[model samples]
Target: MAKIWVFAEVNNGKVDTAALEILTKARELGGEVEAVALGPGSTDAAKELGQYGATTVYASDDEVYADYVAQPAAHALHELVKEHAPELILFATNYDSRDIAGRLSARTGSTLMSNCFDILGTDKARTTIFGGATVVDVALEGTPKIALVRPKSFEPEASGGEANVMPVEVDIPDDLKKAKRVERHEEQASGPKLEEAPIVISGGRGLQDASNFELLDQLAGAIGNAAVGATRAVVDAGWVPYAYQIGQTGTTVKPGVYIAFGISGATQHIVGMKGAKTIIAVNKDEDAPIFQIADLGIVGDALKILPQLIEEIKTRKG
Candidate 1:
């Protein structure tokens, strides 16, 4: 049996879905699965980890470590790994976890195998390369291998089993605690998070201007639960925020249904969303690269098509 230690990330005093997904996957791997829940938010979420198959939850509700600076939590994780010596440590590929994983890898002198889409063997993992044009399998050689998993790679399962929550203290060095959080501005979201949404409708620069994104918003409203996304080009052009960009430099999405409007399917953008279950592309260019991968390719002007689509969906639903 493999010995797995998963870093369970908490947000707003709840166990984040990304953490729970890995925890469930850890259980499926047939191992002694333990969860390390760090920061002030972890205290309220330790029990939630148990329900997802974290047999033992090592928790630290320290205020100093609450903010994710990649220092204090990395230090704590390094100490735990040294003492417990688990064969594997798992981290989500989200922002904070990536920072913590890199810091922890350097501290432990281990090479981090990252953005793994699947666990092939005991120490064998799979990831993409060459702008996601290739999938390669690699074997990790370190004593306790560290792996960062991609988001939306798996679905979360809740298997209600109470965990033995043990409160542990991690010493934060003066240097690591020097920085303090001043303010936070949460992103205003009306529907499911982009990574978690089942349907995603992404627009590109072909939409002409930022104001035209309202067409996407209206289409999303018609779809009822769809999320709007954009290509990096549109985002860089100041037509959309970086948060909405979907590409190698932005967010990787694996929605069930992915609709591309006016996107030419640049390799950078395809790297992020090629994993979507069903792909639909709409662009005036019949030979756009996006059509190569799209399950349904519509050669038409998106601006002319989207308005009709929205009305059609609304009418059908009504």
Candidate 2:
């Protein structure tokens, strides 16, 4: 069987959702799927990969990876890839994964595909272009094909098994450790994370005023387990922090339910949220582009309707 490797990123002593998503998809390719977990909390993260379909996990709990930037991790991964010679390596579309994948691609001179959302077996992967208006399938040539997959592209499923945890040690050369991470700060957020939330209520220019976002908060509160998101325009206008922005340049979300308020559906914005299972759009103009893809479209003022929607939800719960 072909060998496939996934770079499992660890966060707060657990495996990130993106890694599990890739692992779930990789197992379907009929390959012997393995994983590499590095940095702090990697041991704990590695332990969870088996249920998600990783047959083996190369784990390193050393703080050296967390202390330095991507260089140390990239160099170590390069060595492992050379020694193991896996046919494919998968990476999540995150900051650290992007850095490591790019560096590894250069080191190995292998075929590298970025921003991929789907993999068609071991020979090809699919991605979007022209702001997600066009879909392109890329051929995986060369010995060890590398792909950086976008999050939320696939659902994660557990196989109810345990991976063989293999402890590994790699010496980082002095030069590769030049860039050191001095400090890390986590963004404080209340409620469910936007990408992981089951229901996402997003506001755009139609909200009229930034202060009106309180309406979204109230609706989210009433709905329960919902997160608020905003378009790039609102984020650029400082209506919300960049962390709350959802679009091509921001977070991509694939929630079960996506409600858009006054968003005109710019191509860049659509690229990020089109993966949502269900889309409900509200706007004043019936001819808005968002109506084209929305499963349900409302021609009205979002600001005026939000209060009524919030009250109805509250009433239903009561």
**What C-alpha RMSD separates each model from the true structure?**
1.8, 1.9
TM-score of each: 0.93, 0.93
lDDT of 1 at 162: 85
- Please give, for residues 13-119, the per-residue lDDT of candidate 2 as tens digits: 87889999999999999899999999889877776899899989999998888888889898889889978989999999888899889999989998899989999
Provide the lowest-lDDT 10-residue window in model 2.
Answer: 180-189
Report the C-alpha lDDT of model 1 over 1-318, residue by residue, as the tens digit: 668989988766877788888888888888898999888778678888999999889998887676647788888899998888888899988878888899888888887898897876558789989777798999988778899888667788999998898887667778886556667776757897787789999999789999999999999988978999999999999998788988776788899999999999999999889989999999999989999999999999999999999999989999
- Give one clash count per candidate, in the order shown: 0, 0
After TM-score superposition, what is the CA distance of residue 84 in candidate 2 from its true location, in Å?
0.6
Q: Model 1: residues >4 Å from true position, as ranges?
A: none
Query: What are the runs in model 2 whose C-alpha is more than 4 Å off?
Result: none
